[model samples]
Target: MIIRRFSGIILLAASLAACNQPQGADDAAGKAAAEQPLTAVTATLPAVYYDSLQVTMSAYYQLSAALVKADTMGADMAAAALKYHLDSLPVARTGLDSSRVAQLAGQASGISAELEGMLIDKNGLDGRRLAFQMVSDQLYDLLRVTPLKNTAIFRQYCPMAFDNRGAHWLSDKTEIVNPYFGDEMLHCGSVTDTLRF
Candidate 1:
C-alpha cells in the first residue's frame, strides 16, 4: 500500500512537471484535439436520459455519504436534494415504451416519496435509515427493469442491520460502506448483487 501511494505520488509529480513545460505548436494542436468532446454515438438508449439520471445518482451518493457519517442534518439535506432530482428525472425521454416509461416514472416517484417520508418523520435519523431501505429497493427494481448504459450497480446488504433483519442498499461500487450502521460497523456488509448493462 505504501509503495503504491509513493508510486502514485511520483506519477502525479511527473504529470505536474510535464504540465509546466513549454508547449510547441504541434503540442498545442494535439491538446486542442484531445480537448474536443466526442460526439455521442447512436445507442438504443437516449443520451439525455443518461445525463439526467447521472445527476440523480450523484445526489443519491451524497445522501449515502451523509448517512455513513451519521449526520442526520446532512442526510436530510442530501436526501432533499436527491428527492428533488428524482422528482425531476425525465422518464419520458428515456426512449422506453409507454408502459416501461410509466413503470420507471412510478418507481422514481416511489423513491421520492420515501425520501419525503424520511425527511418528515419525527423519528429522525432512524426514520431516515428505515426509509432508505425501501428507497434502495425501489432503485434496484427500477434499474432491473430499465437498464442504464455503461454503468455497473451493486446491491449491498448488511445482515447485522436492524437487529439482524438484514437490509439492502445500492452502490455504484462494490466496496461495502454500510449506511445503516454508519461508523459503528462500517464494513459489516457485502456486495450480494451486481447489475451492469
Candidate 2:
C-alpha cells in the first residue's frame, strides 16, 4: 500500500511538470514574436513624380540664383524652362494604378495651365519672380506635409538642403557628417554671393 501511494504521487508530479513545460515554451515563443521588428511597406512611387520633383528643384535653384543676380533675362529663361518641364512631364507609365496615375496627370496638367498663362502674358520680371517664389514655397510645404514627413526612405534620399538660421538660411548641414561635402558655408555674404556671373 505504501509503494502504491508513492507511485501515485510520482505520476501526479510528472503530470504537473509536463503541463508547466508547455507554458514555459509558449511564454518564450510569445516573447520572441513580440521582439521581432515589423516589415516596411515596399516603395512603389511612380518615376514621373521623381522627374517632376527634380525638374522643380532645379528650377527653384536656378530662379534663386537669378534673383540674386538681378538678371531679369536669366529669371525669365529659368521660368520658361520650368514651364517646359512641367508641361512635358509624361503621365506615369508604371507602378501606380491607372486611377491614381490619372489623378496625378490631371494635377500636373492644371499646374501646366497656370504656368502657361503666366508665360504667355509676358508678365515681366517681377511677376515671374513672384510666381517662382510661390512655386518654391508650395514645394517646400508639400515636402513637409507628404512622403517626406512620414517615410524613412524619403528621409534617407532627400536630405535637407537648407534651414532658417536666425537671419539667413543655412545649407548643406546635417548630423551625419559627410567626409566629402562637410558643412557648406552660407551664401548670404552679400547680394552677389549667390550670383553665378
Best candidate (score: TM-score): 1
Clashing pairs in 1: none
- lDDT, candidate 1, 1-197, per-residue tens: 99999999997676445323333457447645764322322347677777777788888888888889988988999899999988988888877668767767877998999998888884777788888888887777666665667889888877656765667788998887889888777776777678887
Query: What TM-score, computed on C-alpha atoms, does each candidate reach?
Result: 0.75, 0.45
> Which digits, one per residue and each the tens of the lDDT, describe model 2 over residues 30-111?
6447643222214545656556656664664565466456566776677677667766655465365586556555555655
Superposition TM-score, candidate 2 onto the true structure: 0.45
Candidate 1, superposed: residue stretches over 4 Å from native: 1-43
- Model 2, poorest ten-residue lDDT window? 188-197
Q: What is the Cα-based lDDT of residue 193 in candidate 2?
A: 12
